[model samples]
Target: MGLQPIGRRVAAACAVVISGTAMTLLLPGAAAADHTDPPCGPAADACINLSENLSWLMSDGDVTFGPVPVSHGKPGYETPPGVFQMSFKNRDHHSSIYDAPMPYSVFFNGDIAFHEGSVDQQSHGCVRLPHDAARTYFYDLEPGDVVEVVP
Candidate 1:
């Protein structure tokens, strides 16, 4: 009777250890899967959360990179909110209208793009990101991929 109780206690301990080990092994994969599933849904390759002033790179529903800081158009030139497809990319694009250097430009709307610029300053109806973030987004987004700008 005493031996039976001891055996049951041993079994319970073993079960706990096994369960813990299984959880430990499964956690990393679960985390990876979570990251791969895009926070913006499958249709969008990138999502710009305007109110947050942040952007993300997504694939297969996963967020591959970023919540990078961005600056959009100022009061008069407010960046339009809607879904737009990437129209083109230019590594050294210059804005003819503004006659300004717009490096690593990824155009998603008529004259607006995701480009390298001062995050602290507003853009001319464009989305401006820091150099590195703009470059990464420029390369990651392809023409025809969706860019959703949400409030």
Candidate 2:
């Protein structure tokens, strides 16, 4: 079969080495030929998959980190899905509304942020990540960076 066309981002991320009639594709964290594009487009620096409860950090469409577990809003307080710009960041933020400590907080949408929290528990509307992941996101993502939430 002939190869199909791929976008620049996908091609760049998937390193293909063709030798004779054999082709080898090298992708980190991939066990098979799963070369699907990241949840958000190339512009997104962070992408959250709500259904899968996973998140990723990207740079120019290449995944820099993750597929890490995350906890998002539950039921009535569902995490909104859309592309948003990272509003700001706070290393140690306390929630005035919930009276909770949010460390390494990276705010994207209004009142919604990615923070170090319990991944097993449901959040009000924020995306809860582990301490390490939260810290990485806070340090790596800057204001105006794209954060995309997908259902």
Candidate 3:
């Protein structure tokens, strides 16, 4: 299939169990301003909340996955907040700058990407996600897809 804009895609809200409570996450459009809504608007395919360490996948203002755990850049090397389009993806990537492994990498902002790593630890600048989440992001998101990073 060719690239399709989020507004053209159809999807339904999903429910996920967090802690002990089952919560329903409804992805909202650009006009959404509810406190429960994700920081990123409907235009974004993926959204990251740095302070909460959470990420979500969305399609046409409908949640496709998450509110899942993630780890981002720590103190000095902070994950910048902005809306960006995905540039590329690498199933098995090697970081030349850090000389480390970055599996299922989905690059959105320069060298900073969403990659498989320990969610409990901080990264240099990338958004580190659990293995499953990273895999999902890598496969589900295409180049030119929008990604939002919020503080």
lDDT of each: 0.72, 0.80, 0.79
Identify the runs in model 1 with alpha carbons over 4 angstroms from their true place. Answer: 1-39
Expressed as tens digits, the lDDT of each residue in 13-132 for candidate 2 is 445789999998755323233434568888888999899888887888878666667999999999999999999999999999999999999999999999999999999999999776
Q: What is candidate 1's local distance difference test score?
A: 0.72
User: Model 2: runs farther than 4 Å from truth?
Assistant: 1-37
lDDT of 3 at 130: 79
Task: Name the regions of candidate 3 deviating beyond 4 angstroms.
Answer: 1-37
Which clashing pairs does model 2 show? Answer: none
Q: Candidates 1 and 3: which is better by lDDT? A: 3
Error of 1 at 54 (Å): 0.6
RMSD per candidate (Å) reads 15.6, 8.8, 7.6
> Which pairs clash in the backbone of model 3?
none
Q: Assess every candidate by TM-score.
A: 0.73, 0.76, 0.77
Which ten residues in a row are the worst by lDDT in model 1? 8-17
Best by lDDT: 2
